[model samples]
Every structure is written in C-alpha cells, then in structure tokens.
Target: MSAVELNPRPVRVSPLIKFTRWSLLGLGILYGAFHHNRFSKIENARREKEEAERPAREARLAAEKKRASEAEIKYLGELMTTNK
Candidate 1:
C-alpha cells in the first residue's frame, strides 16, 4: 500500500485587489478634502442671502399695509360725501 500526503496551498493576493484598496482610500481622502468644505460654504452663503432678503421682504409688507390703510380712508371719505 502507498502512503498519500496532502499539502496546504498558499494563498495569493492579486494586484487588482491591492490597487482597488489604495484607490478607495485615496478617493475617500480627496472627497473629504475637496467637497466637504465647499458644501458648507454654499450652505452658509445661502443662509446669508436668505437673511439679507428678510429686511426687504419686511419693507415690502409695510408698504403694502400703508397703501391699504390709505385706500380704506379714501373709501370712507367717498362714502360719507355720497348722497343716496
């Protein structure tokens, strides 16, 4: 009878796997450096623009109110002077 022997195979790492790992790490770093702050700045600018428009909006509302009051007074005066 012949004796049989079994040998364990060595695991091999592919170059593609190493490349993918490095690429993913580099992409993560670049995304954080370039995109994070830009998004924040855009958000801040949008907030500031919205805040700046608030006063103009309030002024427009005030003008509309004054115009309405003038119209009411004119209407009351015309009604008082009319004869039915």
Candidate 2:
C-alpha cells in the first residue's frame, strides 16, 4: 500500500446556505448601526444637559464653602472671648 490516499477534495456548500448566511450578516450590520445611532444621540443629550447645569452647580458649591468658612471663624472668635 502507498502512503497517501487518492481522494483529497473538499465538499461543496449549497447555494441556499450561502444566501442565508449573507442575508443574516447584512441584517446584523443594520441592527448594530441603528442601536449605535440611538445610544449616541441619548449620550449627546445628557452631555448637553450637564453643560447647562454646570454654572449653577459651581455657584451652589461656592456658597456652601463660604458659609462653612464664616461659621468656623465665628466659633473660634467666641472660644477666644470665653478663654480671655
């Protein structure tokens, strides 16, 4: 007997199977594109809302910090007066 076999060809795929595979791939591409656009629009809207609120948030934080500083100064001054 020889070392190698006589038949070495690969089997052929059917045309219908090929068509189904290509159509599924195209559908998946379309689904991904739609979801991508939708999510990006939602994210953009959120970013715009945050930008609109930024200045007001900063002002509120600054006011809180100033109040805390004044309270601390008043407390220390009262303590000094009691000690003397």
Candidate 3:
C-alpha cells in the first residue's frame, strides 16, 4: 500500500455530541467539588473536637503518672526498711 492510500481523512464530530461531552465534564467537576466540601467540613469538625478534648486528656494522663510515681516511691521505701 502507498503512503497516500494509508492516510485517511479525519471524520467530523457533531456539534451536539461535543456540547454533551463538555456538559457532562462540567457536571462531574461540580459533583466532585460538592463532595469535597462536605468531606472537608466533617474533617474540620473532628479536628476541633480533638483539640477541645486535648487538655483534659493530657491532665488525666499526668495524674495517672503521678499516682504511679508515688506508689513506686512508697514500695521502694518499704523495701529499704525491711532490708535494714
């Protein structure tokens, strides 16, 4: 086959098909944006809740650590006295 015979003319696409394609693309973008906005709001609310509870959580942990330290010291003192 010759090079000229191998080449074919480009088929023209209908204007209606092009319009439909573009419209669908725009709709997909809008749908994605809506879902993204919803997800972001939920994520932000979760972050705010975590931040609000941080101080209480830290205080509880610190109190637990202090109690454990005191118990260790008392046990050590008792051991030393028994050894003497």
Candidate 4:
C-alpha cells in the first residue's frame, strides 16, 4: 500500500451539525445559569424567612413554658392547702 493510502483521511463534519451542536451547548449553558441563579434566590429567601421566624418561635416557646410552670405552682399550692 502507498503512504498516502496508509494514513486515514480526516473526517469532515457538516456545517449544520456543527451549528446545531454549538447552539445546543450555548442553550444548555444559558439554562443552567438561569436555573442556578433562581435556585440561589429561592434558598436565600428561605434562609431569611427562617431567620425572621426564629425569634418569634423562641418567644412563643418561652411563654408556653412559663404558663406551664405557673399552672404547676398553682396546682401544688392548692394541694398543700387542702392537705392542711
């Protein structure tokens, strides 16, 4: 076999295929960027809401604890008086 025939010829890709491949790549990148940005915004909003509610939730829990303690004390006092 001759040297020219020994080497494989380079494959030629069609312009339309190349264009479609690049377009798909570009659209994929754009979609990923948009979705990432949107996801970050949603995560930030959720974190902010959690931070905002934390204090209120703590205060409510403290109030409930206090009320329970008061009720227990009243019950104990009544029991002592009745026993006397």
Candidate 4: clashing residue pairs, number? 0
- Ten contiguous residues minimizing lDDT sum, candidate 3: 1-10
Worst 10 residues of 1 by lDDT: 1-10
Arranged by TM-score with the best first, the candidates are: 2, 3, 4, 1
CA lDDT, every prediction? 0.92, 0.97, 0.98, 0.98
lDDT against true structure, model 1 = 0.92
Of the candidates numbered 1 and 3, which has the greater TM-score value? 3
Question: Higher lDDT: candidate 1 or 3?
Answer: 3
Off by over 4 Å in 3: 4-9, 61-84
Tens digit of per-residue lDDT, candidate 1, span 1-84? 336537656678799998999999999999998898999999999999989999999999999999999999999999988954
Q: Give the range where candidate 2 is weakest over 10 consecutive residues by summed lDDT.
A: 1-10
True-vs-predicted CA distance for residue 52, candidate 3, Å: 0.4
> How many steric clashes between backbone atoms does each model show?
0, 0, 0, 0
Let me know the TM-score candidate 3 reaches against the reference structure: 0.59
lDDT of 4 by residue, 1-84 (tens): 665777688899999999999999999999999999999999999999999999999999999999999999999999999999
Candidate 1 stretches with Cα past 4 Å from truth are 1-12, 59-84
- Ten-residue segment with the worst summed lDDT in candidate 4? 1-10
